[model samples]
Target chain A: MPDRSHTRPPRAADLGAFAPIALAALVLALVPLWAGDSRSMMTVVTTGLTFASYAVAFNLIFGATGQLFLCVGALAGIGGFGSVIISDRLGLPFLVTMPMAALLSGLFGAALSWVAVRRSLDTIFTGIVTLAFALSFQSFVLGRPELTGGENGLQVAGGADTLLRQPVEPYYVFLGLLVVFLVVYRVIQRSHVGWAFRALRDDDAAASLAGIDVARYRILAGWIGSMMLGLTGALFAHYRGFVGDTTYAFGSVDVRVLVMLAFGGIGTLLGPVLGAAVFTVMDELLVDQAQVRELIYGVITVILFLSFRQGAVPALTNAVRRLVGADQPPPREASSADTGIG
Target chain B: MVAVLIDGLVLGLQFGMLGVGLTLVYGLGGVVNLAHGQMAVVAAMVAARLMDRGTATALAVAAGILSVVALGVVIDRTLMQPVYRERSEHRVLLGLLLMLGVGFIIDGVLEWRYPIEALSLRITGGPVEVFGVAIRRGSIVASAVIGVVGLALILFFRYTTFGRATRSVIEDEEGARLCGINPGAVRTVIFGLSGGLAGIVAMTQAMTSPVVSTAGVGLTIFALIVAVVGGLGSTSGAFLAGIILGLVNTLSAFYIGTFVSSIILLLAAASTILLRPEGLLRRA
Candidate 1:
């Protein structure tokens, strides 16, 4: 039992990073109640919350650990499809199916990390490899009509109908999940596993030399990340009451996640939350300007990558902290672990 | 089946060009240009429009190639340099995402400007028979052009001092720098040359098949698979792997189904990445 705190001391201001996230969560929790059962607005907020969960899941692997898992949609689709089938056949509730589906998704994520890590390939290679998996998943779902219902997908029986009948219910349910995820994220950030992930992300050789099981931690991060993603996907499946092959299309869901995360921030927990919320609102507001919106999103993605690699949340946090400059913690080297050879 | 083989060969040549171009940049610059396919698409679109509007095919293609070459130089000097200087250990992460962003922007712009339709240039040529096989005469021409270009590349790499210097940088950047080779200059040239190669790809696609603006990601994915399977930074390996993948693609499409070909390609690439990251060709 090595002292994890000695690896990297958790800063007091690390807790300060939570202020914005907490405020954001407060707003998210109130959105459905504020909307007073307006379907369209509820839809938009829930959708944003759904994507925000994904962004959180993504941040675990891609943002925190520097492992690239580009197949979140596919993995989540796997979770969604599994949950729907299980619920239909066994007549189980979400409490039972969601975890089961998450387990399956987690295993898949583990497989993705193993496939890439075993070869000791870079993140770019990992992304390419996972992208292949993503494509194959889509092809599989589409190719098998009997199993997956093909492009039409499987309906969740009365799930979406129930949500529609009670829009505020889903709003609370998903927002609760979002809050749980934020807590989990914070726990990971401050825990021993968090320290290990940070260490592994910073320098694999150095981390491995420090008596840490690099493979173990990397795989652990993958499982955790994908499990979160899987839960979100399962919830989304129930929300839409449909899980089609196109639900995980490369051109649609995958790209959307990338854009959302890149725009908000890659590594920061709050960044993804902010990104998902901002981008979703932007998309909703500019729904009619599809082409222009896509073009703008594309441009912003590039611009953010070039100029603001740390993303919106971190930059703002730093600025706020600098202005206040009260009780400043020791400066930690911004971990450059996520960037690697393509 | 014979037509499949002929078509496969032609496709293989194009795949070879993509692999070579991508790996050249990868080996020398350590930057995988995910936007490589978009550059090709842009050129093809330009050429297709020129031909559509009643311009000479040759002149249109020449103009297209020249335009992409310039675009290549401009991209390297302006866009990519900052990505290169992004000043992080996560250059690959940031770099790939940066290029992907650029790719999407280019795609969006093209789709908006164009009719969002797949446009393929139609060349007027008669069918040709060779070795008791009938094939598209255009396919033969494209294959021959690729063959000559590939050969010229091989010869240039073997005989030219500049090529040797570039090769040196690919082999060992620091060593080449010590040996007085300007790695930066070599990389810039490779970037420009890769763009030229992308222009060739666009032209080939126009002659052989339709290319849409959104097709950049797909094309880049295929090229990435081929390059990875061939060996990330190995040229000859890419050539051989390209042919193998092309032939497999044709057979799969013929026998199983159209979508199955991509599955096989993706599977092959994933397995290669997992089981043999160095690639199966055994570059010696």
Candidate 2:
């Protein structure tokens, strides 16, 4: 049965729901003032912003479209590694290489989604296929000695540092990107494209019957998400000044992203941002112990899935909304921000 | 040619041991169990630690299997229960994420104790000539052990009442419920059985190459691909797919580079999924 609850567009100009999130981001933005030129804090905040970008980009496909593409890490790797090649070996400008990296990753994502949609593969199957793609990327990087520098990884050139030297500059760069993308996320959510994605996510057959080209929109989702990931990777590569197989490949980066999204909330805009900030802060506090880091993440992942399915941010948001009386947002409107694929 | 076939067959048998549990768990629960590989690693750790301390190999193997079975049941009851209760489209997603977390924890825990190095169980002899084909004793012994166990499992599924009940649930949960079968209990039994299979696979790994804590993902990927390609719910299909993949892997490695083989195998899996999602052998 078609859900009447989601039949209409959500009330526009109702931006009050986003007030809490804007406050949170504003608080995060003040870390620069809080640190007062501390390089470590600046660096940690920069990392937070970068991963927040990653998680948000991931949410576009995973959260909005309900596609579980595990190869986001690999897509990011392509951007990171591509930057190494373009900036260091090719010595291209940042503008040129950044877009190039984004294009490469975006195209790969599109191709993967095309394959999935064209064949009408299940979401689980899509995950499995992308996982293979992820493994393939790691294997490729690990096997290539000269191009990739093998396990030790390739060092990126100081091309980006010329534009932004201090930790503050790169930190702001990432923060700026996060702010811009958050706006972009809102735009995408309210657009016709967003409705199509949510439709397919809810029911592909129904979406198809309703005259939506499910394959085309799914590919578009993949393209948008991966392009953002690639852009994030390119910036991160320059920001970090290095790109390695271990840092960005299969299990490491993807696992962190998955855990963050799962914990913070899969469908919410603030969820990934909140998750990124929290995990990033936790990461800085426990920098040396990889074991402890994984244990905590694992424990959180299980706990969130078990007891907190709506994720922390959404659950919190819903509670507050409930307290304020019956101005409950339409299911479709609040869905992209609250309901996960589950 | 004969040697290649022999090598592939034995390796395939071992792969089958690795994959059966993953397939069963996925089939019964609609949960991917991302920690599937770690279960085997836990078994290997137990066996390797016991044998390293001078315990008899057979006794250590039995202990390892039992330990894994117990752990599997615990995980299913505690971690998997809620995931199964969820009725959302992303219920599998929740399970996958949870299992991924569990995998990370297991990896971290294993590395904390095992030093991130390879741990092995050695067979006492070198290559032996079997019907004019030179084969390593380790492969032969590993294959024999896993094959016997596989056959026993097959027998159990075909003839046992519990196995029949499990199959009924897998085939038609509503009908099975109507017939008075408790799906939850059957699921728990399958979890135990799957864990035992993981233990067997670990022992196979022990008899062959040493497995490291970090190699858990590698094991999981291999098992998942085999299960996916074989047909999601069919044990026999997974077994056949394992042999086919093993043979193809060996042939590709011989013809191309070792890394090429993995890429090729992965591509093959992708093509299989896109082209025949129900699997090459599975009935739609």
Candidate 3:
């Protein structure tokens, strides 16, 4: 019932947050300049951008609202499969199918949030339930081989004639998506919705006492975040011209996204992008030694969770602050957003 | 129908054992061992490797379980230190993520070294009749072992002084500490016991179906679902939930298809959270 809108000028911290997104966009905009001709390089970067987008979406749901939707891969899979079926089977336009798929995913996410809220489940319980959803989604995909193409996956023919088929064009498309997602994240961070998110994340019972509609805001975050995941997933599927269960499996996608978000900074605007870029490069470097790469990734994940819980960006900023003799306790905005039960 | 029920009960007993391991850790340390299944796989792999080297089956299995117990203690002493320092939600999240990493590491290493290795414990016997239906002798033996272990756990927790100390810590760590109970030691012991339980379940599972290197994640998922449905920290609840889920699983697999059974099991777990977030039987 409160007027959760703010028409006042943005604060200095809020404006400062946009700087990283702009810099990221500018730097990424020029990626196509050098890697334009090399198809493999473009493909890799484009794939990295896709994950970057997924990480950003995850950040919105988790870092903002403390809803640990472990089914990142599942929601994206929904979008990927939905768009593929609608566009390929029904012969609909990519534009129509993409939004429909995204909306469907958003609704599913909202429903998950509704269930979580209605039950008053904690973070881990929410994670468990979503994880169950993720496992079932994988089974469903594999169980219905006739429609989903089973383990072999389906060849996406819907966008074969479009710019999506072009290597460089698809790279830009994913990059564009990543930039837009970052902007959306920044916008949310500066809004009254952001205020409500912070309150509930800090103390849910207190936030509800202060007249914030905890359930509504959590669902809103889940819906919007899932829509982003769905949109990016569908776009990635069409661009790659394939969709499969493994494409969004728990081990393949969810693990990497969680690792990336942790390495980058949970709540920071640039964290997901930074984390994605680093891991993308690491992924490429160890592409040949898959097992070894996974082992290394596992070690890195453990180390990050233990020592670098605040993530690389925050750590770097803190170090820089200390160097500049501005050793005021790290800014509250950059502190850990871990919604722990006090 | 009777054969399926017996098979379901067999599998359910193992599921109950797995849930007990997970629930104990969650109750005592507020840690969710996402690597629970990996521990089982590692133990199975150890046993398989030993058997290949001509070790006695019983000795190999013992060594395997001990190895896992040591692994659990090491993890509790080292990695879980920071995790335990965290309180409530943070502790759960950190523990889950770190254990997930551990699972990945185990999976990566085992797959790299033993891609073709699988543990299949062959019991020399004929089919046994139960309730007018023939059931595999191996299944009956596995179920018997699990039943004994489950009973031992119940009695251990019910009557033992150390078990009472453990319950005290889980109920109120501060109060237990004030009463001179070392919560840290209790947690480490439970973690090791949980690891041992996981190893035992893996061996029993191999009596029914091969426990391969890649079975880690799936095993973990089953354990998680059982623990969640039964209630996070209740031993008896785990067994009850496991039996129920096991029956549901076998029925769905029989009526529908094997592929859809997993989906059905997951749905059951999700609905449990929706309908009964506190789980079937609260804490121990």
- Interface RMSD for all numbered candidates: 3.9, 2.7, 3.8
Categorize the docking of model 2: medium
Give one digit per residue, the lDDT tens place, for model 1 in A267-337.
65555666676677667767888767666767867766665444334453444344325432211111111
Estimate, for each residue in B1-284, the C-alpha lDDT of model 3 and write its tens digit: 88888888888888889998999999999999999999999999999999999999999999999999999999999999988887777778888889989987898888788988999899988898767788898999899999999999999998999999999998899999999999999999999999999999999998988999899988898899999999888889899888889888998999899879988888988898788888888632
Worst 10 residues of 1 chain B by lDDT: B83-92
**Candidate 3: which stretches are off by over 4 Å?**
A1-16, A309-342
After aligning candidate 1 to the native by TM-score, how far in Å is the CA of B266 from where it should be?
A: 1.1
Residues B174-256, model 1: lDDT tens digits: 89999999887787888888888888887876677777767787778778888888887788878887888888888888989
- Is 2 or 3 the stronger prediction by TM-score? 3
Clashes of each: 2, 0, 0
Taking the tens digit of each residue's C-alpha lDDT, what string does model 2 give over A240-273?
7777888677776787887777656666666677
Q: Estimate each model's TM-score.
A: 0.90, 0.91, 0.93
Question: Cα deviation in Å at residue A277, candidate 2?
Answer: 0.9
Every candidate's DockQ is 0.53, 0.58, 0.58
Question: How many backbone clashes are present in model 1?
Answer: 2
lDDT of 1 at B222: 71
Model 3: share of true interface contacts reproduced: 0.71
Tens digits of per-residue lDDT for model 2 on B11-79?
Answer: 787677767788888888877878888888888888778887899988988898899899889988988
